[model samples]
Target: MKANPKAKADPKADAAAAPAGSKKKLMIAALAAVLLLGGGGGAAWFFMQGGDAAAEDTPKASKKKKKASNVKPHYVPVEAFTVNLQPENGEQYLQVQFTLQVDGPEQATLIKDNMAIVRNRVLLLLSGKKASEISTVEGKQQLAAEIQAIVQEPFAKGGDEQDVTDVLFTSFIIQ
Candidate 1:
C-alpha cells in the first residue's frame, strides 16, 4: 500500500474542536461563580435590612420603654416603733425602723397620708412576733415581708390601697 503524500494533517480541525469544549467549560464555571456571589449578596442584604425595618417600626414603643426605665423609685420613711414581743423564757421587745419603697410619688403620698393606720397595723404585726422569730437574718426577712403585707392592706372604710414594693429595715433590734 502506498501513502498519500499530497494530503495535509487537519491540525485546524483538532484545535477548533478542543478549544470549543474548553470554552464551554470555562463559561459554565464563570456563570456558576457569578450566581453563587449574587445569591450570597442577596441573602446578606435581606438579613441586614430585616433588623433595621423592625427597629424602625416600633420607635414609640422603644421610647415608652426608655421612659419607664428612667422613672425613679420613691421611698417613704416610717417612724420607729418599740413593741413588746411575745415572751420567750422572759419578757422581750423589738425596736424596728423601716423605709417603704413605692413606685412613684403618688404611691408615697398614699402611704404617707395613712401613716397612723399603717403604723398601727405594723405595730400589731410586730408585737405578735417572738424574740426568737426575729433573731436571725431569715427570720428578720420574713418579719419584714409580713410587715409590708400588713401596711399595704386597704385602709378602713374602703380607702385606696397602697402598693409597697419592698420593706427596707433601717434598724432592727431584738431585746
Candidate 2:
C-alpha cells in the first residue's frame, strides 16, 4: 500500500516482461521471414517454366487440332442404278447401289446439293462398262475406285476437290 518511489520495480517482473517482449518480436520476425521465402519460391517456380507463351498455349492448341481431326465422317447415299452393260457374249444388265463416304459434312452437303450431276456422271460410267469388267471382286474394286474418282472431281471449275473416301456397294446384281 506504500509507494516505492525511490526503488526500481521487482527483478522477477522485469525478467518476465523482457521475455514477453522478445517473444512478440521473435514471432513477428519468423512470420516475416516465412512470407518472404514463400513468395520468392512461388515467383521462381513461375519463371522456371521457360516463360514461353507458346509453351503455355501448346496443350490447348493440340487439343483443338485433335478435335479438328476427330470430325465424324459423313456418308452420301446414292440411289440404285440399273444400266445395260456392253454385251460381251450376250445381253447383260448391271444393277448397283452404293453410298459415298466423304471426309466431312460439307462435302456430303455439296454432293447432296448437286446429286443430279453425280447421278449423271455415275450412270454414264456404268453404262459404258462391260458386264465382264465388273463381274469379279477385283473388277468390283476397280469400279469402286473409278466411281470414287468421278465423285471426287470438283463440281465447278477451280473449286476444291471433293473428299470422296470410299464407294461402299450395297447391291450389285448382274442379270
Task: Judging by lDDT against the true structure, name the best candidate.
Answer: 2
Candidate 1 Cα outliers beyond 4 Å, as residue runs = 1-71, 156-160
* Candidate 2: tens digits of C-alpha lDDT, residues 13-43: 9999999999999999999999999999988
Task: Give the least accurate 10-residue stretch of model 1, judged by summed lDDT.
Answer: 61-70
Error of 2 at 32 (Å): 50
Q: Give the poorly placed runs of model 2, Cα more than 4 Å off.
A: 1-68
Task: State the TM-score for model 2.
Answer: 0.61
Q: What lDDT does the true structure give each of the candidates?
A: 0.84, 0.89
Deviation from native of the Cα of residue 15 in model 1, angstroms = 42
* Candidate 2 collision pairs: none
Clashing residue pairs found in predicted model 1: none
